[model samples]
Target: MHNEPLAYRMRPKNIDEIAGQEEIIGKNTALYHLIKKGHVPSMLLYGEPGIGKTSLAHAIAGTSDLPFISLNATVSGKKEVEDVVAEARVTGKVLLFLDEIHRFNKLQQDTLLPHVEKGSIVLIGATTENPFHDVNPAIRSRCGEIKQLKRLEASDLLGVLHRALTDQERGLGKQSIRITEAQLLKIAEGVNGDARKALNVLESVVIASDEENGETIVEDWLVDNLIGRIGLFSDKKGSHFYNLLSALQKSIRGSDVNAAIYYLAHLLETGDLVAVNRRLLVIAYEDIGLAAPHIGAHVLAATEAAVRLGMPEARIPLANAVIEMCLASKSNSAYKAFDAAVRAINSGNTGDIPPHLRDTHYAGAAELGHVGYQYPHNTPIGSFGGWIDQQYLPDKVEGTEFYRPVQAGDEVKLAAIYERMKEMKKNKR
Candidate 1:
C-alpha cells in the first residue's frame, strides 16, 4: 500500500531478494539449499535490532512455499499458539514466525515444543536478545539451529537504499527525487548497520524536502539533522557491554596501551564507571599480580578516586589506571598457583594438618595430637626471623607445590626466597 512504511513495503519477497546475511542465505549455503528444497526447519534467529531476523524468517517461508503465520511472543498467548497449531493441523504444515520469542515464559514455550518436535509447526522464532541466555534450554535445543545474525554493514544498508529508490512497485521510484550517493551513504552509515532505521531516516528526510522544479532534493544537512549523535551499541545487562569489558581486560593483559585506552574509552562512553573500575581491579590482581604487587594498591586508589569524582571527571583517573595497567609487567603466576592448589584440593589431596603445624592455643591441647607444634617465632636461623624447617602441609599434600613465581618485577625476588626455603626444608635444617 502507498501508506505503508518504506521498510515494510520493501520487505524481501524471497531469499534472493534479501540484501544482507549472505552467510545464512547465500546461494551456496546449506540454509539456502534447505529452504529452496522446502525442507525449512524450526529455528531461532537472534541479534541486534533491525538486522533482519524477521526478514530472514519471511524469506525462508517464501522460499519454502509454506504458509507463514506471524505472532509476537509479548502479546500472543497459549490460545493464539493453539490457534496456530490448529491451523497447522488443517494445513498439514505451517511456518510459525514468532517475534520477540525470548519474552515467552517457560509454559508458553513448552506449548510449542510438541508441535515443533512433531514437524507440524516449523517454528522460526526471532529475538534481539541472545537466545542462549534468554531462551529456555528446551526451546533452544529443539531448534534446528541457533542462527546468530550480524549487524548489517553500511554497504548492506546502501544496497537496501538503492533498491528502495528504484523499485517503483514498493519504493519511491514513482516520485522524482534527487539524492547523491554520498548522501545515501550518509543515511546508511548513520543508522549503525540498521537497514530499517536507514530506510526510516531516508523517508523522514524525503518527506521533509520540498519539491523544487519537479525534483525533491534530499540534502546532506537534512540527514544529519535527523540522525543526531549516534551512540555506540551497548547495553549494561547485554552481551555487548560484557564484550567491551572483555576487550578492555584483554588489551591490558596483552600490554597494548593504545588498545587498552580505546576499550577503556569505549566502556567509559557507557557511563559505567563502577564496572570499569571493578574490571580494572580484577585485571590488576589477576593479570598483573605479584609481578608488580603494588599495582593492586594503585588500582584500588584509582578506583576509589574515580568513585569520589564521578562521571565526566571519573574518566580521568580510570584512564590513568588503564594506562598504568597496560604498561605494567604482567604475571599470572600467583593466580595460577591458587588455581593449582584448588585443583589439588578438589581432587581429594587434602589431609590432616601435621601435628607441628596445628593450632595450640586451646587448653589441654598438648594432650591431643595437636602437640609438638613447632612455633617458627621460637626458632630463627641467622637473619631469617620467624622461620623454621618443619612439615607444614598435610601428609597427602606434603610435597605438592603450587606457587611458581615468574621472573617479573618483584616476583623474581620472591622466587629466590621460595627456592632458598625449599632447599632448607629439603635438608630438614
Candidate 2:
C-alpha cells in the first residue's frame, strides 16, 4: 500500500467521496441516486485523461458492493472478456470497468453487447475519445446516454490535495510534512484540472524534500519545479484535438486574442502542424471571410512558413497568424451564401440550364440553341464592370440571391456593389 501511487491509493470509495463533476455526481443528480440505489447501469464515461473516470467506476462498485473487475481494452481481448463474463455468471453480476474502451475492435466490442444486455455484466467504459465518434454504436446503444466528466476545477483539486495530506490510512498523513495554502493552490492549478496530476506532483515533492527536525516543508519553488511544462491532454486522433481547433477558431471569431493564442499554443504542443495549419486557414477564410478577405492570403503564407520551419520555431508564424485572426473583422457571409446555394441544390430545386447560359464553345453550339449567351465581357453596363442582365443561374434559381454580403469590412463596399448590380438588372428589364 505504501509503494502504490498516491492517485491509486486515494481512489474514491463512494460517490460522496468523489470531487468535482457536481453536475454528474451531485446528490440530486440521477447518477448519484442510481449508484446509491445499487442500480449501476452499463454506461460510458468520456472526457480528458485524469478526470476521475476510473475513480467514478470504482466508487460505483464500492457503493453498490458489487463484485468489481477491471481490464484495459488496449491490452485485453475476447478471451479476457469471456473470463470476466464467466466470473460474472457465477457471481450473478459484476461491475466491469474497461479503460480506453475505444481501443476495442468491432468484434471485441460486439462481445460485450450480449453480456451487457443480459444482467451478468454491468459495463462501465472509460474513454478519452468522444464515445459517439469512437465507440461502436452497438456498445453505445446498450450503455444508454454517455456521461461526460468535466476536468476538475482548481477548487475541486484543492479538496483532493487536502484529503491526501490528511488521510493517514491511504495518504501522506503519517509524514511530518507541511505545505501552505498558496503552494497547494499552485499544485491544484498547475496540473490543468487533473486531480491525479495534482496528487502525483505533491507526492514527488514530498519524496524529494529532506526532513529537518521531524518536519518536511514544501516550498513554492519545488512545487513549480516538479510541475515543469504542464502537458496538456490532447492527441492528434482524439476529439480533444478537434476541440482545440474549434476553440481556437471560435476565440478568433469572437475577437478574443488571448484565448485564441492560448488554444493555438495547445494545438502546437500536440506537434500536429497539419491539423493546426489547416484549421487556421479555415478560420481565415470561413470566419474572417469577406470582412477581412486579405487575411486568407496572410494565413496561407503563415501556415506555409510554419510547415517549412517545423515546431518550436513553427509556433512563431502560427502565433502571428492567430493574433491577426483574433483582431480581424469577422464575417461568415461567404460561407453562409455557399451553404445556402448548396441547400438549394440538395433540396432538389435545381432547374435546367437556360439555353443561352449553356456552353457554346463547341462547333455545333448554335444548332443546339447554346447561342444568345450575352457575354458579360462584351456587353458591359452600369458602374459595375463587366455586368450584363442575362440570366446565369438555372431557371429555378435564376433570381435567387445567394451572395448577400454583410456590413463588415470589405463586404460593406462589396454589398453596395451587389445592390447596384441588382438595381441595374431591374432597370435593364
Backbone N/Cα/C clashes per model: 0, 0
Candidate 1 ranges with C-alpha deviation above 4 Å: 369-386
Question: Residue 282, candidate 1: how far off, in angstroms?
Answer: 1.6
- Give model 2's clash tally: 0
For model 1, residues 293-361, the per-residue Cα lDDT tens digits are 999999999999999999888888888888998888889998899999999999998998887667789
List CA RMSD, all candidates. 2.5, 2.0
Superposed by TM-score, candidate 1 places the C-alpha of residue 370 at a distance from the truth, in angstroms, of: 3.7
The regions of model 2 sitting more than 4 angstroms off are: 379-383
